[model samples]
Target: MEQRKIPFVIRPRALGNAILVLVIGVLGLVMAHHPMLFSGFRRIQTDLRDTRLIHYLLEHGYLWVCGIPEHRTFWNPPIFYPVSNTAAYSDLLLSVGPVYWLWRAGGASPDLALAGWMISMSAVNYAAALVLFRKGLGFTWLPSASAGFLVAFGAPRVNQISHQQLLPCFYVLMTVFALARLFGGNPQRFWERGGLWLLAVLGGVLQFYSGFYLAWFLMLGIGFAVAAAILLPPCRTVFLEVVQRDLWVILTAGLVGVLLLLPLLNHYLPVARYLARRQYLPMYYAFNPHLWSWFHVGGNHWLWGWTAGREPFRTLGYPPEHLLGFGFITPLAGAAGLYFCRERPICRLAAAVTLSMWLATTFLPGKAIALVASGVAYYCLACLFREFNGPRERAFGLASVLALLVLVSFPNIYLQILTLSALMLCSLELVRTRGRPECQVVPGIALGLFCLKVFSLDVLLIGVCLVAPAAALIAYYWVGRRRDVGLGAVLLVVFFTAVTTILDSPNVYLGALAASSSALLVSAPRRLRPPAWLSVRALIVAMVLVVWFYDQDSLWLSFYNKIPGGIGIRAVGRIVLILLIPAALGLAALVQSLEQKQWTLAAWIVVLVCMLEQGVTTESFDAAANRATIAGVARQVTPGREAFYYRPWPNPGWNTYHLDAMWASLVTGVPTINGYSGYNPPGWDGFFAVDAQSTLDPRDVLAQWERAHGLPPERIQSIGLDRTCEGPQQTRHRP
Candidate 1:
């Protein structure tokens, strides 16, 4: 009469708890980023003057497919008239189409429907992460909630609220969870295993329909995980065993996924072929994450707004892609999880080699001597630390390092002695605790030194002070646990400081060093324990680190760009969305492992800091103006008439009249030649240039387009020029 527990199943209470947390989180996010909605739902979250409008039009295309009055076919949206299959010009949005339709059918205004859809997507993302942590990974409520909050509404993600297509990331977590359930365990029943495989495939297909960027990055992340599993010794047997046992299930699921994706591929292949592949220089400049980017939250962030107009951020080509900040707490918590988790030596070695290659490629030649000298000095210090066993010896070593740090950093002789004396006393007091590990003091010392060296007493140092301790504490904890981990952690800090010192800037080198060092420690030999890499914890750490590295324009991305579909992916930074999966898991693991009350308190403080850091200011479009403009255009472009919209002035940008023209077509079921999307039709550039110069009449522009596309003269029925929407416009017909 005992109840049998099911794997990867959420109990009712856990489900309830997750739902409650998700609701609160979603409401908080709405308040922070979309407060205008409370005044009137019509005011959607958008600047109303960016390429984001195209996403709005794309979602509206789904409403057109649902029996809305539209003269054009579903695939050929009314915009970019005469260009067939125009909906395929960007993400299909097929997965969220039904949801949009339902929201509209329930009598929500277009703007309201779009806003509701975005909020719902964010909610779904949160719920999925909660389920993944609580059920799939067996985490308790606090960590699960914390991780779910981070994945769904992290600082960087909050900056991307306008990118609705990127909002619905539930499938990313779902696919990862499915893979974990399918391969990480041995299920006795064939159907259960098959279902998991099917779930993974379904997740992939949904992601493809959601956004091309998400789909491409999801596959890339999966490939990384699978490669790690296969290459690392600990995970190899289990990975191979699953493949050997469930070859049919895996193959069948894959085939099914391909079949589901074929229709989308057919629509997108031509578009991809027509569009020029992204070049290296532009991609590296615009899409690649610079070292400062990892810490650069957007200008609108609540706590970090002041840092927005600073050095590198001002010079970054694409500001959105540079908003890579994941806050200090979550990553440090993740690093802590990595330190505690066991992993394969080969995995660590591979990661180290990869980092070495990156450092070799990017390191400045002039500073090589400095890097070497610092590295050697750090190595010697680490060796000395290893030999110390008592509190006094540890205190003396830490004090000496502090004094040297203070003296070297400050130029004034009196200031140097005073600062050095204060730091020495603090270091002595930090290590004076009997029974407590001296390594625990390392984080405090590191925090003070980093703040003093980097910012002096600047207010911005608050974030750094809060963040540095988490990293130092985590690294110190690793040192306390094992001799090799201690050495690796120390070397990692030294190498990181050396790189920053030599480059005269902070970059992703620290991340690379931490990842490589963690990997090395994971691979270190363990007695009687299974390979740490085989554990769920190790998988989470490895996947997070790999995704982080790949997002920073690693060599893997360069290799990926050579393959089909890879060259088309310009926004490589978007791949950071995948990090939410491992980040959530890592956070949950860190919270669960905290046994001391003080550590628990520190964790909470870190969480609060993260929330403030992630908080964003919302922007809303003037929905009334947009609605009036579209309606005015719709009145001018009647049924049975394809409109040609031309601006006498040079076309300012895609978001201006072009957006209105597209909206008019969607509303009136009229096709318009003016359109904006990821790519233009074959002859759009030349036609647009000629029209923008005002050399050709509106009719001449339509005629030029028709002639280029080999269309009949009768195809152009009306011309919607600059003032056409205000009054009567003459019908243009070619003789």
Candidate 2:
């Protein structure tokens, strides 16, 4: 092998690298204006109505936890209906545990309870992103940075914030990442960096408890692999052959979860069967791809918005697709990895996972489909970890393809620019496709079933997945970094930069970016050097402008327009604390390195632009918009009785406020007319379904609640919500 020169493609000039950091800092600034940050982070309204659901688990008394029925008070669960999912869901498991713990620890204040929920959700989301990026994308700084912003702040799962379902999904994403790391994260390490045997089992148990998707995912694919291995034997060798990596962990974890819930599951067997179903609304779940085009192209955020003013994405610091929590960039650089990656197994796995994710969204019902497909999101991030150190030939092809595809039909010009830039940077490395350990047959099969939309198969896959790891010795053989194969790095840069500039929002930073394009006018001027004074001066000015531009564009000032000095303080503080100005300054300095007409500078500028563009916001939530309108109506809950009535503005026996068996789940630690252990017993809907014509009788209400709920009196508290009754203290909840 002739000793060929390896140009430092990954290591841009010191100035250029500094610019990338600045751009990332600018993104951090953009994040400061996010809806979650300033909108007061209010809890969802539906959650507010079902107070008992949150409180019953607080464990003030043993009788309440046991499900003994109470009267008129909303101390019992609603009757289970075969038509819908009511009693159990993976999303509920993780939340229930945390809420219970928090309340028992004397943190029962509703405000505190809501805060804990949000914090936990945020942590889970971050953890999931970290796992997805580090393990799936091979652990690069950029992937990790982008993963945090992309996964937590991205547009796909907006409902996560609204519904509080994000935490469990985060847990699930983290589990997959951990598994990937253990199996093949480093060919250098045979297992995780530290032994994680006990941890793996615990994770498996949590995965099952958190969401039903994992269970269904496993059943679909893993079952086939095991059957093929046992019945065919021929394919057994094709999968993992190691003895230490077998099915024991998964089985053990699963058994633990089942045993833990055995008591609850058995006692409520009848109710369980009735409630073990879904609403099954196929038509209600339509995913129009055109919606993406509308959302991104309109550049205003929502699909043209119902109010129809200047769209939301247009005014924000970030783009609509990047932040509103909806769809995001299609495969992009990950598409290139399919052909260009040197770690063939990693590439193959990435392909399988990505395909599965795509299928999950297209085929499955409910939101879990998206969660299933995101399995590839982490895999793609892992692939981005590769860096350039070899031949630059085929390195940029996939990136080029992605850029071109986005340019052709991508509605938002900004997206085209960003996509092109992404593709360019992703192609900056030499990639190889070859051997690596950490492969497991179970996750692979589960991923496949996810795409196919076989919900039942998910569970079996987990079982098989746990066992497959046991079959292989699972050795690690990390590949050395490869350099780019024959390719022109500089030319690629200019082409992408020009594209992003043309496509992106016409903002002040862009103009500053354009003016700074002068720096690219002259690259590595070995013969003629521009004065150092000019570069530093331009850099300082650019940093200041970055901060000013962010504050002006954020328009959050508009919300606080009435408040004195809020905007001035927020903007000044943001410049230093937010980090956007620094990132932009860094990027602007790098642009100065390129010479005019030198397309290589174009490449540098374009990539910087892409990274910077990601930080921009589009629309935001209006704080003035009232959230609790629907659930705010007052419903009466007597302190010691089951009877209640509605009273917001003096209700005259109007049914505006209704109570239910499981109402406890929706109130402030007060027993409600709602809940469940098995299936909804019967007449669950009628608890809140009663007409005001009936007289409000405490004894009668307690009897009704007793019949409905499986709880006894002492455990239930008929706490106050509205003035349903005032005269006497009833003890219908007392045994």
Off by over 4 Å in 2: 1-33, 39-109, 135-137, 185-198, 211-239, 242-272, 276-334, 337-339, 360-636, 643-670, 674-681, 687-735
lDDT of each: 0.60, 0.34
Residue 630 of model 2: what lDDT? 22
What is residue 295's positional error in candidate 1, in angstroms?
A: 1.7
**10 residues in a row with least lDDT, candidate 2:** 573-582
List model 2 lDDT by residue over 108-199, tens digit each.
Answer: 44444544554455445555555565455454434344444444443333322333332235544544455455555433443443334334
Candidate 1 on 164-260: residue-level lDDT in tens? 6777788888887787677554677999999999999999999998788788877876666667667666777888888899999999999999999
Candidate 1 residues lying further than 4 Å off, grouped into runs, are 1-24, 49-61, 68-72, 276-284, 342-557, 595-600, 648-652, 687-701, 712-735
- Each prediction's total of clashing residue pairs, residues at least 3 apart in sequence or on different chains, is 7, 152
Task: Give the top-scoring candidate (lDDT).
Answer: 1
TM-score of each: 0.67, 0.44
Q: TM-score of model 2 relative to the true fold?
A: 0.44
